[model samples]
Target: MKISIYREKLKDKINNKKAKIAVIGLGYVGLPLAVEFAKKGFFVFGIDIDKKKIKALSRGNSYIQDIKRTALSELLSNKLISFSCDYRNIVKSDIIIICVPTPLRKTREPDISYVVEATRKIKDNVKKGQLVILESTTYPGTTEEILLVLFSERGLKVGQDFFLAFSPERVDPGNRVFNTSNITKVVGGVSKNCAYLSKLIYSKIIPQVILVSSSKVAEMTKLLENTFRAVNIALINEIALMCDKLKINIWEVIEAAKTKPFGFMPFYPGPGLGGHCLPVDPLYLSWKSRRHGFEPRLIELASQINSHMPNHVVNKVVELINSKAKHSILEANILIVGVTYKRDICDIRESPSIDIIRMLLEKQANVSYYDPYVSQLPIGKKSLHSIKLTKKNIFGFDCVVIVTDHAKIDYSFILKNSKLIFDTRNVFKKFNNSKVFRL
Candidate 1:
């Protein structure tokens, strides 16, 4: 059969609501995306090697806060979406989107194992004219270099018998403004046909769809967006350290800078860059660049500055504890207010709070934390669990450090109950006294 005839047949299936869409790796990015597709009236199958995750979705229970249980229940009741751990269903899927995790290795390298594994699983079952899209955040050349080779080995010609495209997932976990469906999606394909077909598929769900020239360009777009934030935030972090020495509030400086609203764009200073993207994604580009004999100096410098922030905060804690005549770290109880990377949502993928706690433990400091949003934090080197957040819980800690600024936390209660505090997020609207210091 001609490729165009196959494409037309697939289109007819989709129009008739007969196309089976498979979403691989049902995690933070994948689960929400699967739900969106299911809601859009597609027969969606959410596949994950994690049996527990599959079982939870089968029961219509959502692990992600953004995904409503009722939505899952509706999809399940309608028999529009279901979860599975089997790869045999791949043969029945008309379209497959890879939404696996692209994490950094211990050496700060891009680990594309999950992406590769997903491609390998689908390679054998890939039907003629099936549209395969990758929604994982990865470096340029990933769609071509990583995904294409796997399919080619299976004797399918891309853009002919099958299609391949990269559409980077821009899912912000807690952001109210953007979600899977409304966010502008950027897609690039290995060839012209691939681009057109990919855009057609996504245009059904996303409000706006942008088609880039090639897969590499689309991949590069995601990297540049994150690298821009990483560099700018590093610059502000440096300025914040200087302002602290000069007794100037960096938050006020940022507020004044934001007033122009013309040439300047505001990126605030924080305890440190955390979460999945800003902290880890930039390094993937930098790591890939090294193979081409290129050094991303700005990215490297930014990583250094951002990574050093937790240590700086820890030093401040040591200084404050010593200066106060109350108790030393050995006798003093230290409470870390938030454990998640950013506020509101409970995702600690690359959270800097882990680094802070580890450093404190190395110094023999008794450390405990309270994140109402995150009840249990995975202790890296220590066995300690999340501390309770109560008035009496606050009394035990000699000093508290605010790593994340959750909107739900009662600041008035903390201020009255805690002895002292080091506020990394400037959660307080107004400076009250010496007991509290804003980073």
Candidate 2:
């Protein structure tokens, strides 16, 4: 095999910080990545289908919490970053990344429509020597099975004409300690040259890049990371149920276990697994495994258990309501303290609080929510806004459910005024309040 001229040229562009980069779907993953590259002096084209987001970026507004508006403003003024809804920039870029969403359909099947659409756009305008990488969370073989096939249909050879790789986005929203730049990036390419070029491009922005054998491994690496969390969380969720039955404090048990500091990692139980990855990624693997005649028994069971958590939480709410209000879930003024999947972030893709609210609405409960980070949330035909956490409002709700443990919210105020409290996150540790019922 000979050294490819295209690879060397790409390496030169990356090293010189002169690479023209196109990033599709500028949401949580893409915006941070594009900003990082632009901060590193690469000319980044931030593309998204959402014109609102483009308009926001055009005026130096940031829709993502982790990215600062000042950074975007500085970069835009310096002409290092450009935001648009156009895919025509694809032809002008040396490296193109697809950071689009890979959400599951209503039936819990993998919906790669966003990925397919982004890939199609790339294929329509992809030129020779441009490297394409997918940072979307997807099942193994998606890069080769879907992306490579789509690009090859455009008469582009993988390593020679265009390069392709999968570097799964390890974005933990609201995680201050580790981020898109410092976290180790795992890259797997369709070919050896593809992997090398992919690693090269990411190494320009992200500090650590690890090479895997193939795109399948890189794809599997992401699924495994989330599935591990989902499974362990399911185990802990199930144990929490057991502890509840045994009349034991699960939070206390976790604290005791943490004291060991070895062979024991504590996974807390909550409303359920939420966000983009944990609730959805494992099923993608299980779905693929089933297609390969392999039964991922543990994955299926864990998914079932995690999926039950939101309803379990609702049951806790019902239990609390019944103990006080002398009624069923019907007509109960249940307030959700925080609606986001996790604490202190606005991204609510596949959030369990949504599921809990949906289930509550199904049972005819009057549900309201409050989160400083989220202003409005749309559920079905009705939209719910975050309510004020005043004494009167807190007293109005029959029970308050702390779905997400946001730090800024005055928990003392909630415990002080609320009629009943369902503490899923153990926010009130050892308070021993009669109105506070913990999960």
TM-score versus the correct structure, for each prediction: 0.97, 0.97
Off by over 4 Å in 2: 325-328
Tens-digit lDDT track of model 2 for 281-380:
9999999999999999999999999989998998878887887767788989899988899998987777889999999999999999999989999898
Per-residue error for 239 in candidate 2, Å, reads 0.5
State the displacement of the C-alpha of residue 266, model 1, in Å, after optimal TM-score superposition.
Answer: 1.3
| lDDT tens readout by residue for model 1, 1-439 | 2347667777777777678899999988999999998998998999999999899999999999899999999999999998999988899899999998888988889988999888999997887879899988898899999889889888888877888999999898888878999999999988877887788878888879999999999999999999999999999999999998999999999989999959999987887888778988998899889988999899999999999899899988888888873567665678998889998898987788888988887788888998887777777644667776789999888789999988898988898888889999988758577799888
Error of 1 at 398 (Å): 1.2
Candidate 2 lowest-lDDT run of ten: 319-328
Model 2 has an lDDT value of 0.91
- The lDDT of model 1 is 0.88
